[model samples]
Target: MKNHQNPRRTFLKNAALSGALATLTSGVSLASSPSKRAVRRDFNLNYAPHFGMFKNHAGDDFVDQINFMAEQGFPALEDNGLMKRSLDDQKRIGAALEKNGMTMGVFVIDPGFNWKVALTTGKEEYKEAFVKECEKAVEVAKIVNAKWMTVVPGYFERNLPLDQQTAHIIDAYRMGAEVFEPHGLTMVMEPLSDNPHLYLRHSNQAYMICKAVDSPAVKILYDIYHMQRNEGNLIANMELCWEEIAYIQIGDNPGRKEPGTGEINYQNVFKWIDEKGFKGISGMEHGNASPGKEGEQALINAYHKADSFK
Candidate 1:
C-alpha cells in the first residue's frame, strides 16, 4: 500500500541519507536531526504540526513556529484555537502559512461548545446560537484560507428519546451548512471520546448525521485517537464511512502523544489512508513524547518512522 506521491521528495530524502561516508545510524538520525538547522525532508503525506508542538526548537512566537515547521518540512498546519486569536495574529499566521506553502487544516468552529445541553436537546436557542457561530466561522475561515471547521453535537438531552435527538442534530447542522455552502466551506463534525456523557461518540453516528444533513458543507473530522478509544476497529469503521470524511486528525492513544508512544500502529494506518487516495491534511493533534527540544526531535523521528510504511 505504499504511495510514491512525490518523487522529488523521495529523491531529496534518499540523497540526504546516501552520503558514502555516512554510517547507518547517523543516516537515520540525520533525517530528523535535533540541530538548530536540519535539512528539509518532506513527509510523504501532508502531516501537519500544531502550535507549541515545536516551541523549544522554534521559540514561543507563533509565526516563528510556522517558520520552524516549514524548515522541518511539514506540509500543513492546524490550530484548534485559531478562532480565538486576534485578527492581526490570524492574518500573520495566514501569511506565514501562505509563504511556506502549507495547507490550513480544520479549526474548531464554535470554541464555546456547550457540553451541558448540546444540540441533541432540540432547543431553538441553541440552534440559533450555532448559526451565529457558523457565520463567525465563515469570517475566520477566510482569514486563514481554511476550508474546513470542526463542529460537535453537545451532550445528549437525557430526557428526550434518541430519535428525536438525532433529528435535532441533523436539523441544526443543515442550518449551519446553509451558511457555509455558498462560501465553499465545510463543517467537519468531530466525534470526541473525553467521556461517556458526550453524545456524538461514534463514527457511524456522525456518518449518519452527515448523510442525513445531506450537504457538501457537512462532513466528519475523523480524529484517529478518539475513534480508537470509542471503537477499536479503526480501518473497518473508516472504510464504512470513508466518503463522508473531510479531514483527519492524528494522535496515538494511551498517552495521546506521538505515534510510537502508544499501541496504535500509525504506519499501517498512514499506509492504508494513502492507498485510499486521501490528499487532505492529517492534523498532528498530539503532544511530544517527551519534554523540550529533544522531545521535538523524537516527534519528528516518530513521524518519519511511521510515514516509512510500505
Candidate 2:
C-alpha cells in the first residue's frame, strides 16, 4: 500500500509542470503587449486618465506616467481620489500635468457618500462639515488649477417625502455653490445607476437638481458608463440635459473597461459629443480588459478607433 514514485520520474514531472506554467504565463504576457509610443488622436478638449494606468510601463512613478500619457497624446488627466493624496504629491502631479501640456480634469471635492450627509439630513453639523470640505476643495483647486470637482447628493431618505428630499439637496448645493463661486470653481453632480436606494440616479434627476440649485457653479458630470447601465437612450438623454452638463466621463457598459471591449458604440458616441461642440474633457474612468503594457496599447488603440469616426 506504500508504493512510491521513482525519484528521477518525480523530478521530471515537477519540471514539466513548472515549464508549462512558465510558457503559459509568457504567452499571456506577449498577447497583452504594451504601447511603443503614446497614442495620438485628433479630438476636441482632452481625454483624461487617472494615475496607475501606465504604472507598469512607466515604472510606478507619477511623473513618468504623466510623461507617457503626454507622449501618447493625451492632453488631460482626472483623479477622483486626488484629495486623498498628500499635498506634496498633489503639487508634483500638478507640475507634471502642466509640463506635459495636460489640463487637470474633475477631482472629488465632496464625493456623494460624504457630501450627501448634509443634503439628506440638513443637520447643522453636517452642513458645517460640507462647507468646510468645500473650502478645502477650493484651496486644492487653486493648488492644481483644477476647474471642476465632483459631487453627489447621497442616498434617498426613505422617511422623507421626495419633494422634501429634493428641497434639502437644493439647499445643500446652494451652500456649496456659494463656497466655490468666489474661487471660480465648479461642483459637478453625478447621477449614479439605478440602485433603488440611491437618491440621485439619473441624468434628468441631476439636471433638475442643477436647475434648482440655480448657480453656475453647480453643473452635471455626465458619466456615460453609469447612464448606459441606468438609462438606455444615451444620445437623446444627453441632448436633453445638455444645458446643465459641465463635464463627461466614459467607459463601456457591462464591464467598466476600455472602449472596444464592450457593447457601447463609442465611435458614434464620441462623434455625437464632438458634433455637439462639447468643450469639456471626457474622463476615461474605466479599466483595461487586458493586462500590462500591451493591454494599455490596446486601450489606446480602442480610443483612437472610436475617436476616428469623424
Candidate 3:
C-alpha cells in the first residue's frame, strides 16, 4: 500500500479545519449567538459620555473608545480633562470625532480654582492669572473644536458680601468672555453642590451670575446631578434659569452614577428636556456603579432606559 493518504480523506480533514477556524475567527460561539431582542437603544439629542467610561470594553485607547461610542450609537462624547491632554492628542481626538460624526462637548478650563476671588478680588495679579487661563482655554478649545468650556467661580470670600462676590464673578467672566468671544467659544459656569462654603452653589445663583455677565459667551453649565443635590426641584429651577444655561451635565445624585442608579426620575427629566426643545449636549460626567465591561453596558442601558421616555 502506498504511504500517501487518500485525496478525498485529506480534502475532508482540511475542510473541517477551515470551518472550525472560520467560526473561531468570526467570534461565533454558543455564547455569542444572536438574541431575538435588541441590546441597545437610541436617544434624540447629543448624549455625551466621558472618556475612560468604556475603557474596559473599548480598550485603553481614547480613539478606540471614541470609535466604540460611535458604533454603539452615542451621538456625542465629552472629555472634561481635554485641556490636560497633549496638543497632538487633542488634534487626534478632534479628527476621530469628525470621522465618527460625534460632537465634542465642554472641556474643563478653570474648574473653580479660586476664580471668583481672582476675578472679584480686584487684585491685578489674580485677574491676570484668570485672563491667562482663559487665553489658554481658547487655544485648547480651537484644538479640540470645542464650542463650550466649564468654569466655576470658586468659593466665596468670607470678608466680602454675597453681592460683592457675585459682582466679582461677573467681572471675571466678562473678561474671560472677551477672550473666548473672539474664537466663538462660550464659558459654561457650573454651580457647585451646596457646600455652604462655595459661592455659587445654587442654580439661581449661577443664573444671576450669568445675567450679570450679560454676554452670550458666558452661560451656566446646569449640571443636573449637582443641582438635584443642592435643590430638589430640578425642572422648576431649570426653567427659571433656562435662558442662561448653555450646557448641561447629567449624573444621578447620591451615587453620582448613571441615571437609574439614584432616586431622581431621569425619564421625566429627559422628557422635560425634550419637550422644552433643548438642543445641547448633556455631559455624562459620572462614574459607573458597577465594574468592568458589565458596568459599561449597564451605563449604556441606563441611559437608554431613562431616554426611552417620549
Candidate 4:
C-alpha cells in the first residue's frame, strides 16, 4: 500500500524554506529565517509592530521585544495598553525606543478599554472625566516620546438621536483636544466595527466629528480591519478621509490577524499609502495568524509581502 501523501502541505513548506534560504544569502532587508536574522534595512513605510507580536522570538521582556522589532526592520512600536504600564516601565520602553531609534506610535488615551460613562451620552460629567483622561495621556506621552494617541468616543446611545450623540462626542473630543494641543500631541479617534453599540464606526463619521472640532490635535485613526468590516470600499473611503487621518492600524478581517491572512489586499493598500507620502505610522494592530516563533516569523513575512507593493 502506498503511503498517504500531503503534497500541497509539502509544497508550501518547501516554498517557505526556499524563501528563507534566499533571504539568508542576500545581504538585504527581509523577514529573518528562523535560524538566522534578516538584514535590517529601511522599509518604504514606517510599519509599527505592537507588543507580543514577536514575543516567541524576542522572549517575554518588553525591551527585548522592541530590540527584536528594530532588528527585524520595524521602525516603530505601538502599544494599546500603555497607560496601564507603570511610569518606570513607560520610561524604560521610551529609553529602549531611543536606543533602537524607533518611533513611538499610538497608545490608547487610557488603559480602560470600556468606559462606565459613555462619551456619546451628551453629559457634562462624562465629558469632564474624558478630558482628565486626556490630561493623563499627555504625561504618559511625554514619558514615552509619543506623538499620537488612540481615542474611542464610547458607546452609542439608543435613547439619543444620532446627531446628539455626535454632538456630544465632538464636545468631549474638543475638550480632549485642548489638553493634548499644548503638548503637540494628537488624539486619533478610532472607528470600530466590533459592535453596533460603538458610537464611532465609520471613516465619514469620524471625519465629520474631526471637521467640527477643527483642531489640529484631533484626527481620525483609520484602522483598516474595523473599517474593512464596516465598509468594503477600503481605498475609496480612505481616500475620502485622507486628510483627517493622522494614524493608521492594520488587521485583516474574518480574523483579526496579520495582513495576508484574510481579505485585505494590504499590498495595494500599503502601496497607495506610500504614494500619498504619508510619514506617519502604520501600526500592526492585529494578532499573529499562527502560533509560537513560527507565527512571529509569518507576521514578519506578511509585512514584507505587504510592503513590497511598490
Top candidate when judged by TM-score against the true structure: 1
lDDT by residue (166-258, candidate 1, tens digit) is 999999999998898666677899999998888899999999998787676888989999999999899999999998887889999998999
Off by over 4 Å in 1: 1-41, 111-113
How large is the C-alpha RMSD of every model relative to the true structure? 10.5, 20.8, 19.6, 15.1
- Candidate 4: lDDT of 285? 88
- Model 2, TM vs. native: 0.84
What TM-score would candidate 1 get against the native? 0.86
RMSD of 3: 19.6
Clashes of each: 0, 7, 0, 0
Task: Report the C-alpha lDDT of model 4 over 39-112, residue by residue, as the tens digit.
Answer: 45558887889888888899889999988998988878999899998989999898787666677889987624
Error of model 1, residue 292, in angstroms: 0.7
Q: Is candidate 2 or candidate 3 better by lDDT?
A: 2
Scanning candidate 1 in windows of ten residues, the lowest lDDT window is 19-28
User: Which ranking of candidates, highest lDDT first?
Assistant: 1, 4, 2, 3
The alpha-carbon lDDT assigned to residue 48 of candidate 4 equals: 89
What residue pairs are clashing in model 1? none
| Collision count of model 3 | 0
Each prediction's TM-score versus the true structure = 0.86, 0.84, 0.84, 0.85
For model 4, what is the alpha-carbon lDDT of residue 140? 90
Which pairs clash (backbone N, Cα, C closer than 3 Å) in model 4?
none
